[model samples]
Target: MDVAEENSEEALLIKQHRKEKKEVQAKIQCMKNSVPKNDKKRRKQMTEDIAKLEAEVEARHKEKLEALAQKPTEPTQVSSITNGVTSLDLGSEEPVQQPRVSKAQKRREKKAAQEKERDDRIAEAEIANLSGARHLESQKLAQILAERELQIRQIPSDGHCMYRAIEHQLNEQGNSLTVANLRSQTADYMQKRAEDFLPFLTNSSTGDMYTQEEFQKYCTDIVNTPAWGGQLEIYATCVWTGGALQFCGTTGHKYREQLVLPDINCHLEDGDL
Candidate 1:
C-alpha cells in the first residue's frame, strides 16, 4: 500500500486498540467492585481475563511496530534532462566516462551502512525485550508504576539512574540535592563505615570479595565519577537522609515492596527494584 493508505490503516487500528483497552479496564474495575474480597477463585479468573486482554493489546502494538519497520524506504528522486543526451553527448563524438567512486568515499558509504544496520539491530532488540516482558504480565507491573508516580521521579539513563533517582526523591521533599553531592556523601559514608560494609561487599563481576584497597578505589570512583550506584550506595543515602526509603519492586506478576529503614537492614537487593 501507499504511505498514506498504510498510515490511515495504522491509525484506525491504534484507535480500536485504545478503545478496547479502556473497555477491558472498565470491566476489570466493575468486577473488582462486585466480587467479594475473599473470593479467591473468582478473583483469579478475573485476573486471567485481564492478562489475556493486556496480552492482546501488546500483540497489536507489536504488529504496528513490525509493519512500520518493514515499510520500504523511499528513494530520493532527481530531475533528468528531457532530451536524454545534451551535456554528456559530444557533437558526433564519444561521450566522456563517468568518474568512479574513490576508495575513501566507498569506505565512508560502507561505514554509514554499517551504522544504520547497527541502529536497526538495537531497535529490534528493544522491541523484542518489550514483547518478552508482555508475557510476564507487564500490565499489572505498569499499574504499580503508575501508583508510584506520585512519590517516585524517573531518572535519566545517563549512567546515573541510581544516583539521580535517589537525588530526585530527596529533592522532592524540599531538600536541595545534586547527584554529584549525593554520590560524594554516600562514598564518604561507606568509607567511614568500611567495617560494616566490608562483609557484604563483593565484586559482582569477579564473584570475589573486594579487598580494602579495591573497595576504597571503588568508593573513590563513586565519589568522583558517574559510576552506577547499587544497594550499598542506596543504603548509604538512606543513612545520610536519616529516614527510611521506600522502594517498590515489580515482577510483572507481583510486587515485592520494601521499606529500607536506616541502620536496621543495611543490605537489600532486589533485581526488580
Candidate 2:
C-alpha cells in the first residue's frame, strides 16, 4: 500500500479517539459541576464513575495503538514448488509497469496531503489547549467566580475591550451610556488634565515624553479611533464615571489578553483590561 493509504486508517482512528476523549472529559466536568459539594456520598460515587470511565477509555486507546503497531505487513512469496523443482521468483520481469499518473491525480494527491497535514495540526492544537496548566487555570477561575458570586461577562477583544467592559459594568449599575460617549468623556477629561497625563504619554516611536502636539493627537485618536485604553484612559474613565473598576484573573496578579494588531491598524499599546 502507498504511504497515504497505509496511514489513513491510523489517522482516522487517532481523530476518533481525540473526539471521544474530549466528549468524555466534558461529561466528567459536567458531572462534577452539577453535583452539590455537600453531597459527599454522591460526589464519591461520581468520582468512582469518572475514574472507571477514564480507565476504560485509556485502555481502549492503548489497545488500539498496540494493535496498529503490531499489524503484520502483507507477505511476499519467495519460492514456489512445482512437482519436485523449486522455482525462485526473482524481480526479473519488467514489473508490470504502473500506469502513468495524470497531472490532475498529482494535484489531488497534493491537496489530500495538505488537508491531512492541516487536520493533524488541528488535533495537536486541541490537545495542547487541554494541557494541565490551562485546565488548572480554568478550574481556579471557575472556583473563584463561584465563590465570589461573580460571572464573567466576555468583552469583545476589539482594541476597545477595556472601554466595553467598563461600559458593561456601568450599564449593570443603572447607567445608560454608550462606548462612544465614554470614549468622548475620557478624551475630554484627559485633555483637560493634560499636565497630569502628558507626562506619562510617551512617543511610542521614540522613548521621549509626548510633546503638546503629540498629546493632543493622542487624545484625538482616543476620541475618534478604536485606540486601546491604558492607565491614562482608566484614570479619566474613573473620574468621569465615579465608579471603581476591579480586574481579576486566575492568578492574583493582573493579566491582559494578548492582542496582535498591525501598528497601522490600531494604536494599541500593551495594557491590562
Candidate 3:
C-alpha cells in the first residue's frame, strides 16, 4: 500500500497503454489495407470490430484499477492468516512472462552510454588542444611581429644610435661584436629557453627538469646541426606546453620542425639549434 510505489505502477500503466495504442493503430491500418474501400458492408463490420476492441481496452483498464485498489498489500499479515501455506495443484503449469527491457535492450543501452561518454571526452580533448595551440601560436606570432616592427622603425630613424643596453662586463681583447661572441650568446639563450620550458614541455610539476653530464658531447652535437653547415648558420626556438607545441624563429619567420624538439624529455636529451 505504498503510495509512491502505486504512483510508479500508474506510470508503467500509462506506458503500456501507449504501446497498446500503437499496436491497435497498426492492426487497424492492416485491416484497412486488406479490405476494399468500395465495400460499405465490409467497412461497417471493420468499424464494429474496432469499436469492440476499444471497449474491451477501456474495460480492461478499469478492471486493472479495481484489482490494484483491492490488492492484498499487507503481505506478512495475509501470510500469517493463511499460515504461510498454499494447496499445490501439481498437474497445472503456468507460463513465465519475459521481462521488460530484455538482455538485448540492456546491452544496447549500455553500449550507447559508453559511446556517448567516449565521444564527449574526445570532443573535450580536441577543444583543449585546439585552444592551447591557437593561443601559443598567436602569442609567439604577435611578439615576433612587434620585434620586426621595432627593427623597421629603427632602420628609418636613429639607425646609427646604439640601442640602450646594460654593459654587465667587458670581454678582454675582444671586438665590439664578433661572430664567435654572437654564436656563444645565441647558444646560451637557446639553452636557457630549453631549461625554462622543460616543465611545460613534460607536463610535470616536480623534478630537476633536466640532467646533463656530458656537457662537451652535448655542445659538440648541437654545433654540428644541419643549420650550422659552412657558416650558413641558423638559430631556432621551440616552446611546448602540456597541450600544444610551437616553434618560433630567431632570425626570420622560418619554422623548422626537426630543430624544434618537443616534449620535456626530448628537450633534456637533444641539443637545441
Best by TM-score: 1
Error of 2 at 115 (Å): 27
The whole-model C-alpha lDDT of candidate 2 against the native structure comes to 0.66
Q: Scored by Cα lDDT, where does model 3 land?
A: 0.43
For candidate 2, report its TM-score.
Answer: 0.44
Write model 3 residue lDDT over 1-273, tens digit each, in one string: 365643554445644655665566666666764444554667799989888886776577656644554656565433332331121111122322333556786666556655555566756765785667554654565676687572212111111111101011112223264334434443454555645433322213544433443333343444433123111112222222122222233323343333333343443334342
TM-score of each: 0.47, 0.44, 0.24
Give the alpha carbon lDDT tens digit for every residue of 1-273 in model 2: 466643555555655766676677667767775555555667899999998988887777767755664565332211111100111111211233335668787677566655555566756765886865755676677667788798777564456888998888888889988899999989997787777676677888998999999998999999888789987787678766766666566643333343222122223234522
Q: Per TM-score, what order, best first?
A: 1, 2, 3
RMSD of 2: 19.0
Cα lDDT tens digits, model 1, 105-169, are 76775666555555667567667867686535555655667786743344444457887777777
- In model 2, the clashing pairs are none
The lDDT values for all models are 0.64, 0.66, 0.43
Which scores better on lDDT, 2 or 3? 2
Q: State, as a TM-score between 0 and 1, how close model 3 is to the true structure.
A: 0.24
Better of 1 and 2 by TM-score: 1
